[model samples]
Target: MATFAQDDDGVVVIIGSGAGGGTLANALAKQKIRSVVLEAGKRHSLEDIENDEWAMFKKISWLDKRQAAGGWHLTENNPTLPAWIVKGVGGSTVHWAGIALRFRDFEFRMQSINGDIAGANLLDWPVTLEEMAPWYEKAEKHMGVTGPSTGMAYHPWHNSFKVLATGAKRVGYKEILSGPMAINTEPYDERAACQQLGFCMQGCKMGAKWSTLYTDIPRAEASGYCEVRPQSMVLRIEHDAKGRANAVVYADASGTIQRQKARVVCVAGNSIESPRLLLNSASAMFPDGLANSSGQVGRNYMTHTTAGIFAVMPKPVNMHRGTTCAGVISDESYNDPSRGFVGGYRLEILALGLPFLSAFLDPTPKGWGKQFTSRMEKYNHMSGVWLCGEDLPLENNRITLHDSEKDQYGLPIPVVTKSDHPMDAAMRKHGVAATARCYEAAGATDIIELPPYPASHNMGTNRMSAKARDGVVNKWGQSHDIPNLFVSDGSQFTTSGGQNPTLTIVALALRQAEQIGRLLNERAI
Candidate 1:
């Protein structure tokens, strides 16, 4: 039995105020819709974000003694996987590298091109790229995006990006400057431009890179409609006898359980947590899960399989001078029948590391002698190209409730069961070859390919489609079964595109918020 706070006025409850939730909160506020955003982590101030690596991690990330913190799904279940996620007010966006790229038009229509591959359930998006184009532009503008558009041919590529382009040209590979990241080149929306500190992942001190904490939540609060409850761990959404969701039950920091009622519910918790919440909310009305009429709430999980290839250049490239990823290789991103693989990969150029991470990621053994110090000294000149390839959405690669393990809050732990895709091995081989060619063109000396790992940009679980039988949500991110229930996160992705999914997630959330607002307004009328 939970104590209830009788709330009369209707409020849209958004769970997990990260990239998607925060963006939707801002959009909903703009439309005069009141909202309450429930975030598991504490709100971080600008002062909390400093320059030091360890200190920055302590503040912005789920590091330190509290390893199993449940603010956001930070770790992949397997130790072999390299899924380094963050948790805080801004969620993973707090420690993001901030390389925002929209998926190409073909990405949405993947299933139409190559119908059901073996061991994969590839599906086309309910919405088209053209429908999302305006929303993408809206998200870019709202987030104070930087970089030149393909339409505006005047602005040349940045210095760091130009070098990559030059190198790619030498190797007979065409590289395009990734248009419009959610980072500012010129100060927009009162945020400063990027200072080329090469520390975007460590939480930008200059507020150049857009995070939900600094941008959306504040604006949403100012609208007098959005209220954020920090350190609030939502256990489950409670429903009435009518089968309509009425309130959210959560435990606060002090272990005090409370309930807050809302007309509508939107579970924006990441790919893993969102599915866990849905599966946990099993009532007499919804035995399987709330809004899980299709029984696909925890299926079709997609995560990127990433590999790193380091290149040692003769001239010190000064890799630690700017952003982690300034440019990418996209020549082989499309589905080509000649390649013998359905999906392709992207080569995102990155600054290798400074010292600690470099030493850890490096394949060489660090002996505690003069040889160790000598090897550590060369960490500065090391730069690498991160090869990110799409893993097909397989039903077997799913996230479910661990029947045995439980969290600190006594909730069932998230259990992830993943297996490598058949197309991955061949795709990785091509990636290694392309990486070597790119490095050779850049006048690299010793080029080494690092061990493969999960890229951590995980998606799917609660997907959108034309019908409830096909997916959990509709085209507008509304639950196909439940009219008021909604979702805004990476979990709503139907197709995991070749590029990073954050920007597209933000765009879709913004688009969904508008649609949700209209639906609410129509219902009120």
Candidate 2:
């Protein structure tokens, strides 16, 4: 692995090594640009991945102390853990289920299509889908997505998908199939095919999933232009007198504060921490926060309006015998205000292990009664679907620093406050109804409508806009206030599109890498 000195002022310092930061580091390395990636978790090898859900979760999840507020049920249900992000070198990519998807055309221009929806912070992305098409293709190829675009075979349908597809067809749905997934269907990219272990969210033990821990990060190191430093938690980004980002201060693994000088800094610490880092970096020049001139740095936070629906089949379905979220039904994933919702959502096949089922079955205090035990007993006959919907951005739904609470590093902990827009509730109701009808059509005995679980798709905090006053970053994800600063994560999303954000996050990182590289060559920063 490559190593760089702390005072390497020419190196680009990127915080977090997730889908965006990890991909950006490798992309920059490909352009012969040096970067130092700071990951705030312990490094783990393929041998460390486990097939057990709870075990792997304990091993990789970002178990940091965070608070949740506002009207979102998570405050009461999961107050301390509102988001389900990972820590380690690969970030949440290590725990992702590899469902790669792209946003629809109208999704990029939500405000244009919806036309001034009240109480919603609808804004069109500075970059269009047409502009991102090539990047999306590159991302698909790089991730080895199993789809027609890559000429890669999709995984064989497991019994869980069969049940979901059967129900979907019965309910008059057409686009029901195992959708584009980053998990390999056959040997490709020097990675093995998925071993049908059914614990994809836990981490792929067979190296079949496209995680930066085994892919882009190593490739970047091999290029000898990128250095990934794990167990380094960035505390703040520092800028010069002219307001250009110059260095990052982080705590090393030994709890020693170290400063790494840089020409450019990219923050990709997931949506929550990404903005928290900026807010914590407030200074005399940018008193509110770095690059927070518009006061939008931590506003418009979104996690896909989501819900889980599990149905008990008359016969044994054994939904947990295969991949976690490979099956998808996209018939409803289009804009149609006639459905009482401005945006749309997709119903993807989902399965949880017994442990998670027991917990998420009911998050209430007295949720472990006979009813819960009875539901666990019917686990073998259960089939489930997760609703991935577009969560409308509200200016008030944001991440703010806690009043007094501090973390291990003494930085104020972030309080994620979110509330469901009326549209969100309408869309979720529509999804639950449609999903229940599908299950009923397939002769399901009973159905369980699970509330939103800990957020898996975190997006939209430091979003992009054509005008600097409208957002924190520009189309290239460069900070409007700090020329040398950038947001290389899902936090740069203009709107929460109805798709798994990993693909778009990688595409944006790839695109940003090119822009940053060009700027470096031109000495624009």
Candidate 3:
């Protein structure tokens, strides 16, 4: 057995250091609380970021050559769906395109507007959008957002907002700047302003994007109260005979086993790995999983279904020269009762992708040689929008233990069980016409919608609610079954919002961190 480190007094163990964990670490540090963050991936530097898409697709993610065999795998039970989450210090935020859109007020009350689907367990959020607004504003200010506050873009702080507004208005639709993003356009919080490099998806080497490593984590570390341990993958939450989490078991880079004690454990390992960790921590008290009294540890998995629609314009748009989603057409965010679907979608204009990826969105004429070449030469000025719709939460869609597969640390791998409910498909169908309308309004020539891909925005496994029977965590994201254990990640969401869930996740983490800090100061934990 590897030697264990001396446990620090009043130490809070935080798993995963993405937006949630990083933000909470900083918040707790402000209250003079010490935290130890355990991250599965190593810290990547600016040197790791390259210009090539192929290198980015491989390097930015955790699909290193040696571990590629044991990397995340999709299943036939889940059908065509695939898992695309990154594992690292900043997690998938490193590769994200950085389009931050706040969910409309309607998203907090999905069940109230329309009854639940037959197979789905859709419900309203424990907290409303109003409760989250201040935190959203806090997150915006912390990240130094720059955008316009109008139609699609609702915040006027960013300089790019006006430029996009003009583009949207030329097509007859009132263009509004999107909500505050986590990018630095004018240099705030000691970070430099964005140069509009348009390589965010490949990783922002300039540190213009507000990733946790560059923002929250740095602040927390600077306070001298937080210790970030990278490349340490936790195997399980070690519980005492009384069923209370006392320490975490993990392996080092050399495959040496180690343990570290903690008074409180906060897990922020996203939707996929959070559930996997809990299920692996099963003991006599939690035979199924730790803090799984509701038997809902890994159920109700949801991801937004997205299809990219690219259009070829007549002018030299220079589409790939800026942010991925510079302009959006979200006239469809609110749920229209007449649409025949329970949910609605948002349409945001996307900058053109790389040539190989763009080919997937190309609508070339049948036949081959000459015809394909002719079409490609004509439509190179491609610009487009991504249509994202909500998928209802179904109990059958879950993340369970794989029969034989295990990770390097002898932990059972996550087996995802998923299928799009008919209502979900219908919602996507309902939004198609509206997507075409927006492109037509923008003078798109030869529009083509790409096939649906695995949504990176996954959430709602350990859902939060008012009662233990209806959810796993309470309104504060504290485990009802285990008072000292908390989950402050996307897995705690009761309803996956209509738009991008990153901003809300950040807001929720901040709110929960404050509450936890107060409770810890009073010795509640």
| TM-score leader | 2
TM-score of 2: 0.99
Which regions of candidate 3 deviate over 4 angstroms? 1-6, 64-81, 147-175, 355-379
lDDT of each: 0.73, 0.93, 0.71
lDDT of 3 by residue, 1-525 (tens): 111244753588899888778788888888877888888888887778876666766665654211111112223212323555667778767766666767677787888878766878988877888887788777666655555331123223222223334445665555355534566666667776667776766578788777887777877888888888889888899777777778988887777877889888998888878988999999877898898998999898887756766655656565666665655666566777677666667776566445645344432333257645655665546666677777688887788887786666787667666667777777766666656665555566666666554457778999987778888898788998888889978899887767777777777888898999888878888
Give RMSD (Å) of candidate 3 vs. truth: 4.5
Q: Over the stretch 1-525, how does candidate 1's per-residue lDDT look in tens digits? A: 111233833888888888888988888888888888888778987888877766775565543121222211224222322344566677767867676777788788878988888878778889998999998887767776664442322123444445556667888887556444566676778888677777777678888888998989888888787888888888998888878888888878787887888898988878877888988888889999888998889788777656777766666666667766766778988877567667667888766446534444543343357644554565655667777776677776677887776777788877666565767667777888888887677776767676643335768889888867878899988888777888789888887877788888889998888788788868931
Which portions of model 2 show Cα errors greater than 4 Å? none
TM-score of 3: 0.89
lDDT of candidate 2 over 1-525, digit per residue (tens): 789999989999999999999999999999999999999999899899877778888999999899999998899999999999999999988988799999999999999998988899899999999999999999999999999767889889999889889988997999987969999988989999887889898678888989989999999999999999999999999999998999999999999999999999999999999999999999999999999999998999999989999999999998889888989999999999999988889998999998889889888786777988888899999999999999999999999999999999999999999999999999999999999999998999999989898998999999999999999999999999888999999999999999999999999999999999999999998
Error of 3 at 65 (Å): 12
Name the better of 1 and 3 by TM-score.
1
Q: Candidate 1: which stretches are off by over 4 Å?
A: 1-6, 62-82, 148-163, 359-376, 452-455
